[model samples]
Target: MRFPWGPGDVADLPTVGAGVDTLSDLSRSAEPPGVRLRTARAQARAFRAEFALTGTPDTVVTCDLVTLPYPTRFGLFRASRAIAPFLSITNRMLVIRWRDSDGRPRVLLFEPSDVELGRYTPYFDNLARKTPGVLERRMVREHGTVLGHLARLGIRPDDVDYLMFDHLHTQDLRRWLGTTAHQDDLDARPRAAFPRAKVVVQRDELAGMAELHPLQRPWYQPDTYRDVPPEAFLPIDGSIVLGPGVAVVKTPGHVFGNQSLVVNTSTGIWVSSENVIAAEALTPEHSRLPGIAKWARGWQQEVVLNANTIETTADQYNSAVLEKTLADRSQADPRFLQFFPSSELTGAWTNPGTTPTFSHGHITHGVQPV
Candidate 1:
């Protein structure tokens, strides 16, 4: 149907190959957001130099970096008005692309700006007010450019086959679930926007959310409304196989049903959504520990399932055990020193000493980076 951004001509973009890696590296560096501006400039210089040396002036390649500000409430102890009129949060999105194995084109979308801004609205808002830096502005500018580039790539609103939502923020969930009674209704037509795709989710995790909190009951409708039984939603014990090319892993502790997708691109690329914020407590790498410990602490009781009891019912008891283990590990691990150094359980923004950062598609076992 001739999408907006030349869909079939991915090779024309010179920076496509290194786009994802560059974004990841930029995000992971220890430099303060202010200093990162210079780092970004240096990166652009290097890319230009490499391209020039290669004599690829006619490459016609472009890279779009974006930082989107998600309007949200602020304050840890004090809650903001239900609907604040002003924008008050910050987050980012990184998109990259390549041709798939079947020679069909593909794009990679990562690090949702909305989700991050929702989760840490207060912190980001404070940072923005106190020190407005180049890094922050650059992130916002890049995010806008990326969106424009996507439009150019022919990625029409309709061509998006998969929405692949990692985890819904409370506000986002309310907005989404409030729109329709049946989850399937939301999956169809103009509302669905993205079509011909299964909205994959972790079966056990979905069930757990309904059991844990009364407020989350509405959000659990996606798995419950299906004609099939609970087991039908659960394709695997640890991971839910959605289809031949996609799978959902149980990345608990971010939200009860927070799951991540393992997507096999047509071009031989295996990408994990890595629901970093939603599943922050499941990450094995110590370096990735979030500064705020409370975020992990809040979801710990709701998400973790015991490894020993995983085989028993694969439901209730296992969840209890997982939560206990996370609480224990967070206390004993030195890596969580910044967040939970003294084994003190603090607010939702404070870390409480846990190993394995949880997020969508991030499980402690059987996760091999691609």
Candidate 2:
């Protein structure tokens, strides 16, 4: 719970206010707002960890570094704002260039988006959820610090071995898997932004994040796995297959191990997840996607568990009706199929290209680094 942001935790604000010039950082206070997960024997033991979509995916490459512009809350997702009051979600910090069934070179990063992992108004300030500065000036005019957004795709952070996440809400992972208590004090701790990465989660989400159920620990940062050990954690109790098209689709009820990643691109089979918000909310036909599906009426489509962490509405509606095949029918630009969402993408930010749903390119000026 102690995570405000640095290499994974480094704060130094206080420059002044209309953007305040700077400082005034104050962070991590929302440790309560749960929706489900108390017992049905822990929802039938997280509904026996299921995963679908097999074979036909031995090719890929993709990068959509950043596209954030958020607002229109149903607490932040469930198709937020329904039809507008401002909404633009696209925090796509991705990078995948696959091959590994012995084919090697599997450099990956499922959810790389983190501009100093923006505090997002102390996580909805316990739901008063309003905006005067507009998500802190679009997160300081739009993010940077994900190790310099992976050095603008030229890649680094130990050339990234594998770092996945479809859950671990305001994530931190000790900066990137480098805290075996104190790796012989490498300059004062918190290091490993990638260092040959190996962080594949979902052993029932590290046992439901070691029992953090006080209403899902305010979207959790769980001190970024605090002392991070136990062989640095590779734990997978459901969907496996890390290469030859890359797979990680546990698809649990959004939190007790919510996984989704099935890259096999050229515009096909690209399923990544923040738990089905758009892609038409994985079609049961008509959820054109918008928030407060509270419990979705009439023909029941609101599997809206926007990280509602443990609701288990029929296991998040069978993981949003099997996340419409994570990606296998192809189409990344217009028809909106490659289902990607680690954050910032609820409805083309403001009806830009207008279709079923759309987001494109992803890169915006200045470019800072440290």
Candidate 3:
């Protein structure tokens, strides 16, 4: 599909292959799981080499959105029982400044998690009911708003030309993109978060929100899109290249429309998504955390998922492999992979056995335009 703004026709750009483009392709593929994974890995390596040749983005920054208590079982894919019941997951917002192919500057915001509406998600709603203000009290907001961050960078809301997310889970689109219908719950009319930005999301993910399956219902807030105008979204199938060194590729299994942001930087290529909550989870064999390596070795699993639901477990596993393949090895710690989780697991006294052996605290590359 051609974007009305920003970079034009993604179809005209290069691709790894049609087979690895979409989740449906991977799901219905006739090739065996191992065979498909190996093949995709090989392709990704070649693609990574080619991607490295592209110019790096002007600036890339990750800001804290909000940190909340998350289930330990799901975070580690039930690999351990010794960890705290809940671990803190700091959801982040990644902002990138880059020059389009035409050499015009552009801004892209990835994973702008709406803290307010996020609490209303079924899973959090249930947690809130069990203990009122407990979830609220535990929530951390040390980092300011996305708008505030943009202002510090001298970017107006209208200056943002593109917006994206790893997936649509827990996001409330009504506020991000103004709705045509009135929102009685808000008790006020909501305007677009970034007046001119076009939301680039997976086409399938948007459809999944229309009628969520029982398993997906808990993690998603579909009603958030109830009144959002269709024109506000730029739904594309499979993988797409937004500009130099920036791509959003389908990374299915976490959810139907799940995708990951890949950006080529001076340090190397960095991938962002919630496929794995911790860096050690990617290189499980070398994990220092309790039960991770043992579980991976016992199951012969190469990667541990940030598992919530397992309906698409295998697909999610393959997608994580794809991410590992695409990302460059970390310079700080070669043992740990360069896959940065959108919601990274932070080690604190409150949550034991959840500390990551290696953490890429935040990425800072180049300078945002003044």
Best by lDDT: 3
State the lDDT at 13 in candidate 3: 26
True-structure lDDT of candidate 1: 0.30
Q: List the candidate 3 regions with Cα displacement exceeding 4 Å.
A: 1-24, 132-136, 139-142
RMSD of each: 17.9, 20.3, 4.8
Q: Could you tally the backbone clashes for each prediction?
A: 48, 20, 0
Candidates in order, TM-scores: namely 0.33, 0.30, 0.91
- Winner by TM-score between candidate 3 and candidate 2: 3
Each candidate: what lDDT?
0.30, 0.50, 0.79
- Residue ranges of candidate 1 with Cα displaced over 4 Å: 1-142, 145-149, 170-192, 195-198, 203-246, 263-370
Report the lDDT tens digits of candidate 1 across residue range 1-370. Answer: 1111222222222211111122113333477644554554454334323322321110112232332332221111111122332221123333333344455543334332223223333334454675458745533333343235457555553433233344443212222112233335336312332232223343444444333354343323333222322221112224433333333334443354444433333222122332221222232232233333443354432222212112222222232222222221222343321111101111222112222342221112121112
Instruction: Give the candidate order by descending lDDT.
Output: 3, 2, 1
lDDT string, candidate 2, 148-220, tens digits: 6567656677877777777777675665766756634235567666777776766566666655777777777
